[model samples]
Target: MIATVVSSYPKIPNRPSPARLRNAINRFDRGAITEEEIRRIEDEVTEEALQQQAEAGLDLVTDGQIRWEDEQTYLARQLNGISLNGLTRWFDTNMYYRQPVIEGAITWQKPITVDDYRFAVEHSEKPVKAVLTGPYTLARLSVDQHYGSVGALAKAYAGALNREAKALQEAGATLIQFNEPAILQHKREFEQFAGLCRSLVDGITVETSLYLYFGDAEGIYPQILDLPFQLIGLDFVMGAKNEALLQSAPFTKKLGLGIIDARNTKLESVDEIAERIRSLAAGLASDQIHVSPSAGLEFLPREVAQEKLRRLAQGVRQAEAVLV
Candidate 1:
């Protein structure tokens, strides 16, 4: 079994702290700091995140998205016809992301996340997974002034995402993941969203995954299982309905079992996590299961996040032993 994070790791411990980085970004915008200095800070943080994941012994790792301002705004800013308008609360978190304003037709101007993925690959011994915000989530989160409707915006976003996914694949990314936390709110448009996800990965040869969190997935479980993704991640911690959903639905794809709660500060025992995985493993192949925090580790403190990762790795090992 593989142990990994869904997306986003905590920021580097110190030296180029969040405050310092924010100041650097502000300085760069005001022409007080050079672009090279900003790049240096980003590289330092990215390397620290990668090293932390490596030290924790994860089977698959992510770039930790250190350079990202927020999940959607960073990628949205790279596309044409979208502007960062103002601050908006991100989901239920204390943090905020600049709201993406869709002013006109959306088009991919350049590779958004490929360079970061490549950087992580070069710095780490572990294989890196290229992570992107899904088309559905991007469309749902952005203010749609030009697209007229969510469906049209999603379609446009999918095409742009396809270009980015292909770029990551070419950059030696064997695994690609699209984060669509907004899908939980748009359950009625399941079919349309599924098709959009398919469009995003049309010609990509690498393994693809769709990670849904922050809400219940039980209502759309059976339908979501049919999506073209090779893996489906469900937040069992937040979505208590997922337990019944998993039991009732036919889960043919690999399961990213979210047993650790990323939002909560209290540490979960490795034995408890292992038991949850063991129970889920009874219904699926041992190799088909992957363990992760219920969502991104960004909600926790840096030291807490690192300990959670260690527990995740230990829990997977214990669960796999039972399965064997």
Candidate 2:
């Protein structure tokens, strides 16, 4: 399906807008402010960001992760297996995640799709992807509460989340992406995680995509080639070397080439990024490629992020011109 989508692809630039920032602010202010205030802000900011993506010429637009607290905790809230804990130090980066602590056996909190799909349909004309953190990644990031192996915990989480994905599909979502940045940490287990993820949404109408970021994807390249997902997101900012991995791996999966560095504030030039995309697309056909930022766009200031996305989207156009 990604191959078909890319075949006669329009000249579109994809970028993250101010939506994630507004969501972050709302996450922090949730208990402090009224629930009505949260909904109003989410609607207002999401509307503006969706318009900005369309105006910026983004081909495929996301909610910029506006509805998430962080990636993992968002799923935690939706699934009954865990509870959200306050921030904890991330390994090396200045980043800290709102951790999810497993409190009991896994279960769906309720039907998890209504609000996300409703918002996407209401806001954007372009295809909107419903994003969730993969269950295995969530379990890996969390400390086990008497569960023997992390894999067991991950599989349990996967079942509940896949149901959520199914619900999203029924509610009019056309694409559903599960973000699994932690999969890079467990190379030996990557394929199993991917398989488990695949099982969750197998027959669902939504086109499924899996995203990995924040680490070199070299070790997991071969493992990913056989997965059944329609699209795979790679973090070029951190995994540029994985560009070579793409050349070696023989698969027809759509590449979500994350060309923009999302964690930094300094805007990258269109020329530099265009050059990289040209080199990266050397063997890959135009139909095999899709472009995005390294990860979510909340790392930079709202203005910086906007500039970065604009340049990234423009860079793709410049690269396509060069290729043609």
Candidate 3:
């Protein structure tokens, strides 16, 4: 079993030292910092995030999405035919993300994250997993003013992301993930969303993941077991019912069992985390399991998130030792 983060890690800096990234963004907002200066600060924090993951002894790492303003707008800003307007509350979280307003046909103008992924791969000791906002989630969250039909809007987003996925693969990303928390929330739309995801990853050769969080996936249980992607990340922390569902229908497909709680500040004991991993692994091959946090750690302070990753890695090792 491996310890990996779901999508993002806390990008906030620990206290005592100044929050350069936060300060830089505030400076930029006031037209004080240059675009180049803001990017430089982003790079510095991205490196710090990657270094924290490496120090925690994770087998895989993400860029921590330090450059992303939010889950949706980062990718949307790169695509044509969309303009971001007004902040909207993101699901139940207190955080707000800029809403994308579609005005014309969506098209992928250039590589959205290839350069960013390459930078992470270059700096990190571990293999970096590239992440993209899933098309279904993007379509669901965004307001369509031009495309009238949801199907057309989803397909257009899917088409654009499909190209982006291929570009990441060609540029040497072994693993890429699509964040689709919207899927579990709108369970009735699973069939259509799954079909859209399947079409998005049709010919991409590299391994891919459809990461679902924010709620339980009980409604799509065994069907998720049959997904074409190489891995599926589900939130077992908030989606606790999924534990019972998985036990009722076990499979050998790689499952990212979210055992560590990223939402809380207190650290989960390594023994407790190991027990959850052990209980979850009893239903499948131990090698097919990857322990992760409930969701992104963006809400937590950086110090807490770093310790969580360390505990996660320790828990995996303990579980593996017992299994062996």
Top-TM-score candidate index: 3
Please provide, for model 3 over 186-215, each residue's C-alpha lDDT reduced to its tens digit, 9 standing for 90 to 100.
888778877798889978988888788888
lDDT of 2 by residue, 145-194 (tens): 84678888888888888788888878878877887778787788876777
Candidate 1 per-residue C-alpha lDDT over 1-324 given as tens digits, one digit per residue, 9 for 90 to 100: 999999998865544445556677889999998999999888878888888998987888898999988898889999999988889888888988888999999999889888888789899888788889999999988999999999999999999999999998888888899899999987999989988988999999889998999987967878888888899998988888888887786789999898899998899888888888888767788888878999888889888889889888998999898788
Q: Return the TM-score for each candidate structure.
A: 0.95, 0.86, 0.97
Stronger candidate by lDDT (2 vs 3):
3
Q: Assess the local accuracy of residue 207 in candidate 3 as a C-alpha lDDT between 0 and 100.
A: 85
Number of clashing pairs per prediction, in order: 0, 2, 0
Alpha-carbon RMSD to native, per candidate? 1.8, 5.4, 1.2
Q: Sort the predicted structures by TM-score, highest score first.
A: 3, 1, 2
Pick the winner on TM-score between candidates 1 and 3: 3
